[model samples]
Target: MDFNKIKEMGLEYAEKGKNAALDLAEKGRTQAKIVNAQSKLYKAQRQLGALVYSLAKGNEENQPLVDKYIEMIANIEQEISDLKASLEPDTVIETTFEDTEEAADGTADAAAEPAEEKPEDDEAKTCPQCGAPVSDDALFCNKCGAQL
Candidate 1:
């Protein structure tokens, strides 16, 4: 087993996972912003409906109610403005591992290659007594040693 090759492959996988996680986070932020905007629009429409109802039933008793509704609408509009300003999409600056100095060598780094494992060959020697396969360079079999 080549330990260096394993380490390189692990590093490559880790980098890809990191980038994917960051992309998901960015997408979530965008969706949240859109949902928030829709909620604010719905609330504003409801406030407008209340204002129209109060105007249609004008009376001295309803004057205070109309004033309160106007103030509430103003507050909601301010809140929506602030939310719009705050809901800007999070900016992400993409980076690449290939931008490093080692990547300038132009040999297409081995870490970028897919793993190609070969099957193990049958090169073991057989024990005389137990007939079990032993390592080719072994001096004796672990089980039933027959001077292998």
Candidate 2:
């Protein structure tokens, strides 16, 4: 109940709060670095794979060097996969590739591309009375007529 003691206690709390904030900021910066690294790795892997595919398309003579690049790309992909798995152990990552649209001759259109479907979560509220799905603004459960 001394003025000096109260000021010292307040200062201590302030310092603790400041340190916690700094720690959180450092964590944010580290997370950003991890995201940037993952993006760069993916870009590099795609570029190398494209190069190998183009080489194989042009001639058979470039097979040896293309094989080498393909091997390196595979290793890079494996490493990226392992690192991603470790970084996001609790996250479920799914990749869905759609079939390219076809032409009149039953062949795929040269310009047509496969689309990726994004997974979406249902945001509607569920009724506790009968476990029925309901709109978020509902005042009563539609099935059981129970008040929400």
Candidate 3:
């Protein structure tokens, strides 16, 4: 029934929303990096394959170039692995003395309210090639690199 309490509740919800948006943005950036690394990895592998094939046809070998490609590919793979690991959802535990005090005072209901999240719609579109969820705005599937 207090106006100040209602205002505080609104501010809390707003803060939670802002934090969730920032988290989502960070996740999107990580996913984009993974996709870029995947593209580079594919290109390096293809080049290595071509070089090996040409060398076999000519009965020649370039150990140095081959080694370079191998090293580059390994590094790219490691980067992709790290980025993908970062994409894994994080578990955040946020607790403070104020939270404990509020709970003891039976005012924790404001904090207990669930954060807003976009739900999966019944009509959500999926990638035809990989069956992974794809946003309507996406030109390519994030999971399997399929054209959407």
Counted clashes in each candidate structure: 0, 0, 0
Q: On a 0 to 100 scale, what is the lDDT of residue 122 in model 1?
A: 50
TM-score, cand. 3: 0.57
Estimated TM-score for each candidate: 0.33, 0.38, 0.57
Q: Compare candidates 1 and 3 on TM-score and give the better one.
A: 3
- lDDT per residue, candidate 3, 1-148, as tens digits? 6999999999999999999998787667656656666766776687778767877988987776677778868877876666665555652323322332332232222123223124646678788998998655443454565544
lDDT by residue for model 1 (85-105), tens = 433444223322222222223
Shift in Å, residue 92, candidate 1: 6.8
Query: What is the C-alpha local distance difference test score of each model?
Result: 0.47, 0.47, 0.61
The best candidate in terms of TM-score: 3
lDDT of 1 at 54: 50
List where candidate 1 sits over 4 angstroms from the true fold. 1-6, 56-148
Candidate 2 lDDT score at position 4 = 94
Report the number of the highest-lDDT candidate: 3
Q: Which ranges in model 3 have alpha carbons more than 4 Å from their true place?
A: 91-148
